[model samples]
Target: MRVDEYNSFANQLQRYASALSRLESLHIRLADGCRLRAYQKRLAQVTVDPRSAIDSQLVIAVTYDLREIDEVNEIVENLPATLDSETLTLLQKVASGSEHPDDELDAPGREAQYELYLGTMLRRGGIPARHGKPDLVATWHNKEFFIEAKRPASAKGFDNRLRSAVHQARALVRPGIIAVCVDQLVRPADGLMVVKDFNALAPSVDNLVRKFVVEQAHTLRKRLSTNEPVAALLLTARVPARIAATGHSSLGTSIQLHPLLAGSIEAKFASSIIPLFAGSPS
Candidate 1:
């Protein structure tokens, strides 16, 4: 009511504002890496002008509004839309407790599956192929060899994955072939639950495939090509399947080929040798 009383009230208000600003600064710092919260905290804290002497009063006023029940309600109402769809879905999963957890990433196990499948595919055809780290090791036509697998064509970073696979394959042997496999998902059953979220998971499928097939092939090829017994090949999904070898020079390499869906894997294994020996060598 009096001049001194009004001054005292103003000072008290300013102190409260200062305290609120400090709290907001702390909140902003803590939220730095939190993508969604970071933006919200920033919008709340940004000063219209930082250099002005009266900016402190403005900051205090803003903080007062931001801390109110009404302002908190407003922020909560609009926070979800800015997040990515996948991240939002994950947030929902976290909220509802519906997401599944993986026991392990299982990189090597999948690699072994590719190795066994390639070996079975070639060996059944009497190519004398066996699974080897970095590539398949085979003794076809009295020559030692290596084979690498490449992933399908319609994917990104196939080249980079291929490079790493080649580097890894090189460690195992010299003169290897880098093979790629391109196709739709090839689980034994289309209806089976092979993937948790196929649409979300499809983009990453080829990366793993390349790791399983191409990386191994590149490693084996590098090792075999040095005349120290190495070879590599890529089994890309094609209308007609083919074989390629890159370990040897003039003697060259060969592929005992098979049709993409000639029959069950067992049947194709039996029939592939005819093509290996019968097809003209490159």
Candidate 2:
């Protein structure tokens, strides 16, 4: 994503606050004492102060909270006037508690959010898509494409997650792509991504993501070699970063496409669809 396109910390916070208020007014059943609600309350207590000393833990929490809110807002804003049962169910799941204790980024809720996020992005890219049985079903150039998104909390579980997504994608009658959020795989230690200037943010983030992708190129190639239905591995990451120059923080997102092979049918499909998802060539 471009630097100017990134949402400011204050903007994201305000967006979340408004979203939370709207949900409350609608009588949506958000979890009692949800961490997201708490994060909003805490963030409201202070303004962005670059020099202010804040706990790294709070920064991490706020970063994830803002990203989640943005995702939820995207999904909500794009929904059709009449809500389908499937979409409603997915929203409810997102509103539920985190899948694991003391961790809001785990499976179930975050996982559902990721699916909706992907669908939203695809639609924004002018591809007709929606969250469904195969995680996502999208149409481009009059052809349907199935997508399966996964968020593995750790590297140890990545293989299994990829395998599962591949299985799901292969079952579909249309072409498929496996999208994985590799945040945990490349995330730095808490508080490590403090940048000094806005100009440096994008390069710093790109370097981190690129380095990881390069290091794992062999492993990724090995894993996707035999997965015929899977046209490509869409690896994505969102890192929480603090900008000392602005005294604020935001999530930096990076996406990379690793095709199964060059000059093949699947590779062509992946190349054509990836620009839509990434908003540019990956």
| Cα RMSDs, all models | 26.6, 3.8
List clashing residue pairs in candidate 2: 50-247
Would you list the C-alpha lDDT of every candidate in the order shown? 0.34, 0.67
User: Least accurate stretch of 10 residues (summed lDDT) in model 2?
Assistant: 97-106
Which numbered prediction scores highest in lDDT against the true structure?
A: 2
User: Which residue ranges in model 1 land beyond 4 Å of their true spot?
Assistant: 1-110, 150-154, 184-233, 238-282
User: What's the TM for model 2?
Assistant: 0.82
| Superposed model 2: Cα runs more than 4 Å off | 1-5, 21-27, 47-60, 97-106, 217-219, 261-269, 272-282
What tens digits encode model 1's per-residue C-alpha lDDT throughout 164-265? 556665575345555544332221112211223323232233333444455445543443344332232334321111112311101111232323223433
Full-model lDDT, candidate 1: 0.34
Q: What is candidate 2's lDDT per residue for 171-223, written digit by digit as tens?
A: 87855788888766676644446778767776777677788778876766666
